[model samples]
Target: MTTARDREILRLAVPAFLALVAEPMFLLADAAIVGHLGTLPLAGLGIAAAVLQTVIGLCVFLAYGTTAGVARHLGAGDLRGAIAQGVDGLWLAVLIGAAVTVVGVPLAGPVVRLFGASADVADPATTYLRIALLGTTPLLLMLAATGVLRGLQDTRTPLVVAVGGNALNVVLNLLLVYPAGLGIAGSALGSVLAQVASAAAFVVVVVRAARRHGAALRPDLPGIRAASRAGAPLVVRTITLRAAILVTTYAVTVGAVADDQEVDLATHQLAMTLWTFLAFALDAIAIAAQALTGRLLGAGDVTGTRETTDRMVRWGAWSGVVTGVLLAAASPWLGRLFTGDDAVRDLLVPVLIVAALGQPVAGVVFVLDGVLIGAGDGRYLARAGLVTLVAYAPVALALAALSAGLVAIWVAFCTVFMGARLVVLVHRARGDAWLVTGVVRAPK
Candidate 1:
């Protein structure tokens, strides 16, 4: 009973899954390489990564917003408009990236310090942060370009670029870190170079495609402003989400300090790394949902949009079940792959089991989030995100204050935080409020 819609979902999700995992693979590799440097360095990498991820995560609207916009244009049979919208997103990425790098580089040490990491961990983190901030523009460029391709229903190019970039990153990191004696800084440098190369490849693809379709390559000021306006709510939504993660990180740090063990921090980092990888892996279906939903809605096919979304939700739930089972089964040995410290490995096992149990919830949340984003419902998402954060923050802070162990903190996150998101998303998706149809989303 394989249908056209099912085939399309598989086609997009499979490659999207591969490409999505590559980013986390970058961190996984970094953890493996840096972990041997000892707990201090691994912990340092965690802090640096949190800061970097927050910046990039906040601007993800560049990708999500652009994908929705471009897909809508393409679905309406305006290929020129699709490319034009994507071009504006690219310009915004450049401008924003430059501003972020300028401001972020100088503030790296202070930001790392704000995490209250000890001097030993803070020093290396500052070094890594300073170096990695150089790649901000390229990273944003990659995000924007990836959005364009996804909207165009071409996931294969990003898959190829991600694979090549990851390969180059591993080679450079191994050479620079061990052979050249650059330590943690070398890892950051390697990642930056890989990001730049990948960004260039994407830009080339997008530019050629634009030329072929007779779309203007230059920045369109009005279009850029419109894109910004459209993305504003998503930006707020993303901020709230990132804030939730930051709050969770802070709680973890506090709990670790209470336990008086660096292993706790290192273990939390490892768990977060695995969780991130799993999140993206599960998001493959969501990526498909975003693209297909946008296209269906744009073509004024409300029935098709509803049917596709219903199917994707079921797919997401089953995918989560399978992923959770595998992760739970792998819990014992998973830590050894990232770190050599027996303490970190021992502590990470149970924490991962707790994380594993949450995957099913995460799967549904990711899909519904994507569905809403594709339907251009950012305003509701932003408001819901704010409310969820408001509700979860106090519980997380209280747990940390009670000196709950890492396991308890994760339980609150998995059950309470994710549960809250699921409730809101399910409520939204069950309605016709987000089912508006047209090339352009009707303003809320």
Candidate 2:
């Protein structure tokens, strides 16, 4: 029998899953389109994507923090205030995005080289990075706006926007890449255009909602400061998480070099893309956890929060099993869909299987991470993330030094990085310490 809580979780998680899946669909489209260009181009996309994701991933706190703050206010019956806080988050996104562009675009060449891109791969990677940089503001705005809607318990809007944007991206990539003869540049441009369109759609939705609810559209200085303060620890948390990802990318690149295995690098990229896509699918439940947990706490329903956490965990674990089965079954065919390289596909199969086996662990970590964020436990999350990174580093370093195959690298990801995440998160979630409720604290 499905209770109201079960209905609520599914209501939020199902759409959130669709929306999250659309995100990686953009990248999947890019990989497929660019993969046809040849190995160097595909490799370049891998390098460029790592850099782009790292920068944007670091600022993901804009969404997480805003969602928590907005949900809390909405729970406390301050709908207008909730909208105002979300507006402040959008403002911060623009500010950060601008600063990143100013520093990132001009340095694209050097950045690609830093990723250990071979000379043949560097130019295209640099081209892709610089072009993608043009859309950072729009991407950041979309992240924050999505968070705002999620906090309001509305995931359907984001799902529609994301799905439509992904379809547009695919169409544009088809037209611009071959017909326009723009090559990898066309792929990057298509993604940028899609991001801008999605951001515009979000703006229209948010502005109308604000006007309807009498929320201030203009920026408020104190509110902005308060949002930033609440997000500070989240920023730290994001940094650590991004660092883990960045290091993994770097380790894979360098490890392939050490082993004189260029094809393995491409295979790693293909497998990692699948890994990330699956993660977004799992993160949908996390999004639900974040929203509902925040609302429950605001309503002073600790009992509900606890119960919801248990249900989400159970759902998450089973979802992981289902995802793993599907991924493993598809491993043989999955790589061929992305790239035509036989060598790359061969190497990708085993690596993907290893990744498949780890989905349950991934599901657990993602949900608990969201639960803590929703509970406004960013301080502990930040510190715990750093500790997890420290624990994972030696394993990553050893894997790189050993010049292990793609499977070993993934094994490190599962056992070292993700394992550490599971330990810390489970330890916290089992305790009552992370169940904080009330208004978000602004740092003194």
Q: What root-mean-square deviation over C-alphas does model 1 reach?
A: 1.4
Top candidate (lDDT)? 1
Candidates in order have lDDT scores of: 0.90, 0.88
lDDT, candidate 2, at 22:
93
Pairs of residues at least 3 apart in sequence or in different chains that clash in candidate 2: none
Question: Could you tell me the TM-score of candidate 1?
Answer: 0.98
Residues 1-444, model 2: lDDT tens digits: 338889999999999999999999888999999999998888888888888888888888888888887888888888998898899888888888899989999999998998775787788899999999999999999999998999999999999999999999999998999999999999999999999999999989999999999988887778778777888888898889888888887788777764445576677778878888999999999999999998889878898899999999988888888899999999999987878889898888889889999999999899999999999999999999999999887788778888775688788888888889999999999899987777665643
Q: Give model 2's clash tally.
A: 0
Clashing pairs in 1: none
* Per-model TM-score versus the true fold: 0.98, 0.98
- Candidate 2 residue-wise lDDT at 139: 95
In model 2, where do residues sit more than 4 Å from their true spots? 257-261
